[model samples]
Target: MSRLSDMLRTQRFDDYRFYHQSTINQTLHLISAIIFLGCYALLFTDAAIAGIVGWLAMLTRQTGHFFFEPNGYDAVNDVSNDYKEAVKVGYNQTRKIILLLVWGSAPVALYVYPTLFGLFDPPTDRFDFVRHVGTLWLAIGIGGGLARMLQLFATRDLTTGLVWAFKVLTDPFHNIALYWKSPLKLLRGELIDSSIADADWGADEVEEAPHLT
Candidate 1:
């Protein structure tokens, strides 16, 4: 339990310092986290609606990473962009692009095939079509996460895979906790998170292995 907690903390800390340097990005993540909570609530009663909400949150979150976060050499972390991408625990930019392409194509494929080559029942109306798409999106989201988790199990260790999965599942609540003040910082005209430079997790604690994606 202690090891798991430590790894989770390290992953979260590394994630914040490496990726979330933009106040705008942090603020967007806060919003995305809230939306994800809504999706979680709807998951039990209406999975299709939850899927729609989840993707909306994902887009909001990714927009911040893609458009706002800096992608240059990390002066604070003293690592190159390529280094970070290579060691990233979860989806790096390249993998994210592929995942997004698959996500984007799902609806189009469903639209053209209607039944998606007999995988789904033909929708009776537009709403039903959307629901079907949402369901498929939900599956894709789960599959994407699980696929990465399994990859980690093969490449890293069981503990690393489990920890990453746990981190992803609980990220919404954690983001809200971590970034609740990000909006105020953005309002103060702080474009970058200056405090990230002060992050001191100790060099000995840094993971030598590749992280999740």
Candidate 2:
């Protein structure tokens, strides 16, 4: 338990220090986190609505990473952007692009093949088509996470895989807790998270970063 807890903290700290150094990005994550919570609530009752809401949150979160966050030599962390991407435990930019392409293709594929090559029943109307898309999206989201988790199990270790999966699952609540002050900081014209420089994580004690496989 202690080891799991420590690794979780390290991963979260690294994520914030390495990736989320922009106030705008942090603020967007806050909004995304809230929307994710809504998606979570709708998950059991309406999978279709849950999938749509979940993707909306994901768009906000990824927009921050793709557009707002700095992707240069990270002076604060003393590492190059390439180095960070290589060591990222979860989806790096390259992997994210592939996942997003698959996600984007699902709707188009559904549009062309209404029954999705017999995977789903033919839609009766536009609303049904959208519902089918959402259901397929929900499946894709789950399958993507599980596929990565299994990959990690083969590449890293069981504990690392499980910990990353747990972190992903609980990120919404955690993001709210971590980035709630980001909007105020953005309002104050602080574009970057200056405090990140001082967030020392005992460099000698913790692993420098996760090993890429």
Candidate 3:
């Protein structure tokens, strides 16, 4: 875990240094990709429209990560991202995009399903074009704002402390003591050795092994 720096505007790499690999995040990504693929298949004629939407999203995000928010991993003359600030910026941006995509999954799924099924039936006025527009805009705005906030954290912007403080207040359900203890402990290099989780039989803990593992 990287600690926040105490600076107004630290250099490119002074900011950003906290990390935790979450499988929930990976699952969300897989779901989003599968949803997009579903939409692509619904396009029928090779889904030229859905293809454009995906390509545009990809190009825009890649541009931000590679150029404007380049990771500081190699910037500090280190082997990889040694918990550097630039790398933090890149990661923060990635989170924002993920949030946007997560928000978008529902609407995109709706768009795809009805279309795929409707192919055999009469269409309903070519779909809810307005709702789709709203979803896209909402994803872009929310994602961009969140990404900026995370960038501020990396830069040691004065608002970093306030931002996290507000997050703790608004989303207290996330890091409760008993439930999320595993991930939090892992971050501190404390692995909670649970034989119940490791046991092959004789316990229901086997059902929830991944949560602790």
Candidate 4:
């Protein structure tokens, strides 16, 4: 139990330090986290609403990654952008791009095909169409995470994959705890987080980032 806890902690730490150096990005994550918690609650009541809210949360989170997070060599962590992506336990930028591309095209495909390549029933109205899209997006969200988890089993190890899956599911709670103060810092004109401590700790966690197969 202790070992599992430690792995979760380390995964969260690595994710934050490596992926969320920008204060703006952290602030967006904070917002996403809050919405994700709400979506979690909604899952028990109205799963359709949960899926819609989940997409909103994901959009906010990815917006920060694509537009705000730093892409240069991480001087604090003494690693390059490529190194971090290669070692990333979960969706790296390349993988994320593919997911996002599919997400972005879903609406278009639905519009053109109406029945979405015969997967969904033809909608009677716009609201039905939107509901269908939301459900499809929901499947994509769940499937993407599961697929990556399985991929990690082959690429890293079974334990690493399971740990990462847990981290991804619990990230809303963790992000809320970690980044709640980020917006305040941004308001005070701090555009980048002072991640020196995180970087130092990360370096100790792994002497060299392992290249994935």
- TM-scores for all predictions: 0.95, 0.96, 0.30, 0.92
Instruction: Identify the superior model by lDDT, candidate 1 or candidate 4.
Output: 1
Q: Residue 189 of candidate 3: its Cα lDDT?
A: 57
Candidate 1 lDDT tens digits, 140-182: 9999999999988998888888999999999999999999999
Candidate 1 residue pairs in clash (backbone atoms < 3 Å): 89-211, 89-212, 89-213, 90-212, 90-213, 91-213
**RMSD vs true structure, all candidates:** 1.8, 1.4, 18.1, 2.0
CA deviation > 4 Å runs, candidate 4: 198-208
Candidate 3 per-residue lDDT, tens place, 1-213, comes to 123322212211122112222223222223334444544464575343554454444444334334433334442233254333234433345465675575556456546664434432323564454344434544554455566566556665546534444442222222222124444444565432232123232223122111100
Model 1 residue runs over 4 Å out of place are: 201-213
Error of 2 at 134 (Å): 0.7
Candidate whose TM-score is highest: 2
RMSD of 4: 2.0
Worst 10 residues of 3 by lDDT: 204-213
lDDT of 1 at 148: 91
lDDT per residue for candidate 4 within 115-135, as digits (tens), equals 977888899998888887877
